[model samples]
Each structure stands twice: as structure tokens, then as C-alpha cells.
Target: MMTDGLDGVVAASTILSDVDGAAGRLVIRGRSLDELAGRTSVEEATALLFDGFFDDRPSGGEWRAHLGQARHAVFAEVAALDERLIRHGPLEAVRALVARLADGEDLATALRLVAAPAVFLPSYLRLRAGHAPVAPDASLGHAADVMRMLRGQPASSVEAAALETYLVTVCDHGLNASTFAARVVASTQAGLTSAVLAGLGALKGPLHGGAPGPVLTMLNDIGEAGDARAWLEAALARGERLMGFGHRIYRVRDPRADALKRALATLGVEAGRLAQAEQVEAAALAVLKDHKPGRRLETNVEFYTAVLLDALGFPADSLTCVFAMGRSVGWLAHAREQATSGRLIRPQSRYVGPAS
Candidate 1:
């Protein structure tokens, strides 16, 4: 028997991360999610992911310099992309532009793919907002340079650390939709660029990485603390799904949700909005319990993800692009893993209709 969405189907073996849906646990490279998110930087997580894979892997001071150089190397490409491509949104433009980088399965290609968004996103967003793009500072850390490029100034320690938490928290999960897409592309012997482009395309879907934007929209609509329950009730009455409250996998609270909430609390910006979200979360959880008694619809990562990104001054629409920045590391990691299998990812499909 086949599952409709390939549910519960074990595709391939991986040493990267594991998603224990029953326990609501995410373990990356043998470390718990909580231990990695707030404490580890994205650069550190990248090193963890590429530990046994890449031959030219840099560690300690060398890794930071290598990554910083890669970011600086991509500046011209970000600036040279056509202005018209922004019509498809920065994320789509990012997908198209990544294809312009050299194709390979080597460490250099992996580093460049990882660095593309850190350079491309801020540059693209600034240019789209009618400002001149800022160049990357090769001396700064990954999250710090992203913020620097965005604001044309150094980020506060709090802001930079929050962004680092966000990036590391999302650096890799289980074989999520986008990662799976990347792996499938890689299985076909396609280059890293093609695999990453496939991942970006998959991530663009609303069911996947697009919900964070609407979580903010929902918060905006509710407006006040006392209004959350009533607003949520009316929404549920209209059969509208709450944006951040449910997940397809986790039967308990999403582990990343707490990690991100903690990250936002660390930043301590936009206290009023954060309080409002907390109230909204409590109200939504209570209401959902009363409404869908049998279902486990708890807060997921995107709930606090929205709050933190908003606190950092990112527009809601750009949340997905920001997500891509962190997740790009995971995509490339999975792509490289799949490419090593030496077996194409060809699964048999059963025809349900007339066999002509």
C-alpha cells in the first residue's frame, strides 16, 4: 500500500538530523535542538553538518574567514542580477540568481551556495527598497554581516545573537520538504546549484515555508490582548486555520518554537508586540483545545519566528527569504549526501486510473 503524500515512508538513511514526531524532538548531529539553537552560531552548525563530508572543510578561525570571503565573493553577482527579477519576490529572484554560480559537488561550490543568500538577500532587499546595496564585511560573522548589510551599520550584540539563533535553529531539521526536494534533485546527478534551486522552489509553496508571514498578519488583525480569544473563535468559525498553531509532524509543541521564543525574549525589542503575541498564543491554545478536542494543535516554530523577525525589523514578506538564508545550509548538506548514494531516487508509482 502507498501513502498519498508519502507519509511514514522511509526514503533514505541520514546521519544529519532526526525528527522524533512522537516525542517532538529534533536532534542535529547527535546534539539536542535546545543545546544547539541559542548557543551555537550558524557557522558552528555548518561545521557540524559538514564534519565528515567535505575534504576542504575549515574549522575554528579559518572557517569564519573562509565563509566571510565566500560572502564577499558573491556581492557582484547579487548587484548584477536584473532589476526586473524582483517582480517574482526576492526569494524567487534568489533561486534564479543562485543558478548563475558555478555548478559542482565540491566544497567551494557548497560554500558559495551557503554564502549566496547572506550576500544576495540583503543586497536584493536594499536595492528593491530603492537603496544602494551594502557590501559584505569579510571580518564579520555570518549573522552579523547579514544584519550589517541590511542596515548599513553594525548590528547590536542582541540583534546579531538573535539572528544567529534563528539561523542555527533552522540550519537543518529532518528531511523537511525543501531538503527532500534538494536531495531528489541531487540524486539525479545534478550539480549543487540545480539541487539548491529545486529546494528553493519547493520552499516557495505556502504549505511549507510561507506561513510565517501570515502569523504576523494574524497578530496584527487581533490587535489587543483581550481580543485574541474572540478573534480566534471567529476565525475558527469561518473554518480558517490558525497560521502558527499546527504542524504536520509534531504531536506536541514544536521544539523550535520554544527556542525561537527564547531568542526573541533575549532580544527584548518590541515588548508590547511580544506580550500581545504571548496573550494571543495562550488564547489560541485554549480555543483550539475547546474546538478541536481530539487534535494536538500547539504552537509551532513560525509563531515565535514571526515575532523575532518582526522585532528585528524584517517585513513579513521577506521572512521566507530570511528562512532560505539559514535553511540553505541544510539544503546543500542534504544535496551532497544524496549525491553520494550513487543511486537515483526512483520510487515506483502505482497508476490509479485506466492503464492506457
Candidate 2:
């Protein structure tokens, strides 16, 4: 019964959060993600996360804007390095960029820490495929800068709003796997960037946050609407866990899904793709309802994440890094929270495999 590290010993109540997995609800500081996502900017979410952890949040748009500027400025430092840098994978190039920013201290350091992957990772992906990364203009909003960099073009207000919603929605969660990993690194007093690197590494695992982009691939390969059932059946029959249908923590439909689905709909999702996606959701839900009825294996956040990001033109390969954009805020907030608590997080582990 000891899973992973046997570290799950009923952790004491955390003012941090409460996730009702069976209900698929999350309460961050007593506010629901749905209520928060629609009206919040990524900046606002960051403030809420650090509300208790920090007395001074970069107040208003200042902290968010500052982080945006810092990410742009630091990433630009390496934009010229793209030619040779592209030879390295996006993740590696990203790690190097963080290393370069290791010198800055104050707010600049925190900004660079939060924004490193957001700026560098997308740029790295572009440079690898012979595309140029766009330079960031501080005047632009955070979501706009992200979309502009990812697409190499300016973004409309709708695009910016939708992307910001995503970044905010996923910005923080009660200590999930990746956030906990980040806190573990942060507990050592490692730099914020170091904590994030740990999170990204954990997220890269297929079982964690890596499956959303693939969900789109599954949808595409299913192609015609008629093939969804048979194709999904074959995939399931072969023991493949259908990518977007279930969740490790949520039981009912994921609350994040509704938030994202609402955002995607507001963005007026792309024509046939959205419709196809709707159809796919319908078919998949029908199947899961019949096959795993008691399990509550409904569409999770990843289901809508694929649809939303694809609508925004993110390549599947970039999804993990894209996810990092939103989730990084949560990582930093949690790291700061844990650090402020002064607990070193030394959990006990039971060894089972043959302790030499």
C-alpha cells in the first residue's frame, strides 16, 4: 500500500487548500477556481497565492508586469544565442537561460524565476524549427506577450484574455505532485528557478501533466466523427489509458474543465475543430458512462486544455512548457508558502524492495 515514497501520512491541515477529488472541486483560499478564472488575471492569482505568504504583493499590475518585463529582458539576453542554442532541446535551453539569470537578486530574481520557462521555452521551440522568437515589449500584457512569442505575431484581445484565463486557472492548486516537488526543492532554500525546474521535470512524466497535448492527437487521428467509438475502443482494448477522459484526483467533471471550457467558448473556438472536439467529448463521455460508470471517469481539465491550446495554435510538443506558464505561478506561491512556514518537509519513507 506504500505508494511512491510512503510519504502520504495524512498531512496536517494546510491553510493552503482543500481538493474534494470525488466532487472535482478545488477551493483556493476559500474561492472556487471557476469564480476566480473568469474575472482573474494571472497577476491577480499570483497576489492571492502570496496573500498570506507575502505582505507586499507586487500590488496591482506592477508585480505581474514586472515579471513579464523581466522574462522578456532576460530571454532576450539569449535570443541571439538561438542559432546554436536551438541545437539543444527547449527544456535544456530553458535551464541554461535560468542559469544565466542566477545573478539577479531582489524582485528581478523572482521575476526571472517565474518567467524563465514562459519566455525561453517557447522561444527555444521556435528557434529549433527555424522560426524566430519575437522580442517582448513591456507595454504589452502578460498573455499578449506569451501569445505573441509563441506565434511570432501580435495577438488580439480575445487571444490574450483566453490565454490569461488559462494561466490563471492553473496558476495555483493545493499541493499537487508537481507543486510538492517544487516545494521540496524550495525547502532547501534553492532558488525559485531551481524549484520550477524540479516541477517541470516531474511534469514531463507521462503520468503527470504530459498527456493533454496527446489528447488532441488522439482526437485528430480518430479523424472522421464516425471513428471515435471504434478508435477509442481499440485504444482502450490495447490497454492504453485514453488521454483526456479521466483524472488522478477528480471524480466528477473537473471544475477546471468548466472554467477552461467556458474560456475556450468565449474565445469562439475554431470552426470544425471545436465541433469535432464537442462530438468527441460526447462520444467519450457516453462510453465512459457506460463502461466505467461508477468510476466517475469524466472529462478532466486536460480534455479542455487540448481544445483551448490548439485553438490558440500551440503545437502539441509545446503543451508541457505551455502548461508550465500557468502552473509556475502556483509553484512559486507554494514554495514561498512552504518556506515561510519554516518546516523543512523531511517526510518519512518506508523501504520495501530489499534493503541491502
Candidate 3:
């Protein structure tokens, strides 16, 4: 028997992370999402995730220093960012710059691949907006430095911590599509940069990393909490799929969504906006249940992701790039894991075409 989208297929065994979709839980390197999201820094989480995967991986304290160095190293490629590349936008522009990186499976290579988006994203965004790119401050933490570079000023401790929560929460999650794509490339011995590029290509798809922007659009269209039900009902009547309300794997509320909602609450975003979003979420869940009685649909990460990142002042267009920055660590770690122990990911497909 064959399955569409290879549903329920077990591709590779990993010691990295596990996604228990049935329970709506995510565990990374033996720690639950809740334990890490609000407490761990991105550098610390990366250190945890990278342990045993790389020879001579940095300790938690050393991880920050190494990541800062990686950011500085990746900044050299920013000179390649010209008008033509800027026109392609942040994601494509960062992709192009990342392509320039030398392919390798070593610790240095991993750091650079992880750092590429942090350095390249802000540089591209700034250059596109007619501002000079800011240099990396190796003394600062990874999330803080990215915010600092993006705004040409330091991010408040609260802002930095909120971004850290997002980064840690999404750092890795089982064999997600992009992580699987990274693993497949790694299995081919294509090196870390190539694997990450593969993952980025996969994530560029709308069905995956592209939904957060649309969530913001939905919120904008609805305008107010009182208007949410009518707006959602009309959209559903027209057969429109509600953005950020469903997931392929999870049958319950996404834990990451709750994590981000908490983070958004701390950001002190416009009281009305957050309240309206909460009302909209409640309204969306109730409406979705009424419309699709047999299906499980609840708010997923993208819903709160839109609100939180928007509150952080990142434009919706650049949201996916921001996601890439958080997820790149997972890609590198998965690529390294595959290269270390896994084989080429060649799956057999049943013939469905008309017989010759």
C-alpha cells in the first residue's frame, strides 16, 4: 500500500527531537518545549541541540562567542548584496548569499550556515530600505544581536528575550518537511550548506513556512473582534481555508502557539490588537468546529507568530526570513546527524501512471 505525501512513513531515526502530534507536544533533546522556550537562550539551545552531533561543539557559555564569530564571518558576504539581489527580497537574497558559502560538515561550517540568515537578513532588509548594514556585535547574544542589527540599535532585554523564546521554541521539531529535506541532502553527502539550502527551498513553499503573513492579513481583514465571526463565516461559506487554524500533524492546539501567545502578552502590544486577536482566535475555533464537525482545527503557531513578530516590528514580507533564522540551527543539526549516521534517503514509489 502507498500513502499520499508519504503519510505515516518513517524515514530516519533521530536523537534530536520528537513531535508527538497526538498529544500536541514537542520535545527537543530530552527537554520539553515549555522548559526551553522561556528559559533558554538560542545559543544555549543550539549548544544542547548540537551536542554529540559535532566534534568539539561549544559549551553553553562558549556557544554565544562562537555564534557571534560566525555572524561576523558571514558578514563578509554582504558586499555581494547589490541592487539586483536586493530586488529579489530578503529570503531570496539571503538564499543567494548562503549559496556562496563553502560546503562542509564541520563545526565551523555549521556555525556559518546558522549565522548566515542572522547576518544576511538584516543586511538585505537595511540595504533595500536605503540604510547601511549594521555590523555584528560578538559580545551580545544571538537573538539580541539580530534585533540590534535590524534596527541599528540595541533591542530591549524584553524584546530580546521574546525573540529568544521564539527561536528556542522553533529550533527543532522532529522530522518536519524542511528538516527532512535537509536530511535527504545530508544523506547524499552534499555538505551542510547544500543541506540547509535544500531546507530553505522547501520552507519557501506556502503550505509550510509561508502561512504567518496570511494570518496577519486575516486579522487585518476582520478588523475587530466583534466582526470576526461574520468575516470567518463568509470566508468559510466561500470555501476559503482559515489561515493558522489547522495543522497537518497536530490534532490539538499547537503548544508553540501558546508559547508565543505568552511572549506576545509580555511585549505589551496594543491592548486592543491583542484582545482582538484573542477574540478572533476564540471565534475562529468555535466557527471552525461548527463548519467542520469531523475535523480537528485549532490555533497553530502562525496565528501568534504573526502577532508577535509584527509587534517586534518585523514586516510580514520578512517573516519567513525570520523563521529561517530560528530554524537554521535545526537544519544544520539534522544535516549533521544524517551525514554522521544515515544513508541516502531513497524511497520507493508505486507506479500510478497508465500501463504502457
Number of the top candidate by lDDT? 3
lDDT of each: 0.88, 0.75, 0.90
Q: Alpha carbon lDDT of residue 325, candidate 3? A: 91
Candidate 2: global Cα-lDDT? Answer: 0.75
- A best-first ranking of the candidates according to their lDDT comes to 3, 1, 2
Between prediction 1 and prediction 3, the one with superior TM-score is 3
* TM-scores of all predicted structures: 0.97, 0.90, 0.98
Model 1 bad stretches (over 4 Å): 224-226
List per-candidate RMSD values in Å.
1.3, 2.5, 1.2
Clashing pairs in 3: none
Clashes of 3: 0
Model 2, 6: alpha-carbon shift in Å?
5.2
Residues 17-98, model 3: lDDT tens digits: 9888889999999999999989999888888888888777766678889999999999999999999999887789999999
Q: Over the stretch 1-356, how does candidate 2's per-residue lDDT look in tens digits?
A: 55674344453346656778877888877788777887887667766766766554576758667766776677665655555666765555666676666632234565666677778766776777678777776667778888888778888889889898888888766667788898888778776777777888887777777888789889888885468888877777787888887876776888888888888887764767777878888888887777776777888888889889989888786777778888877777777766667477787667669767
Largest TM-score belongs to which candidate?
A: 3
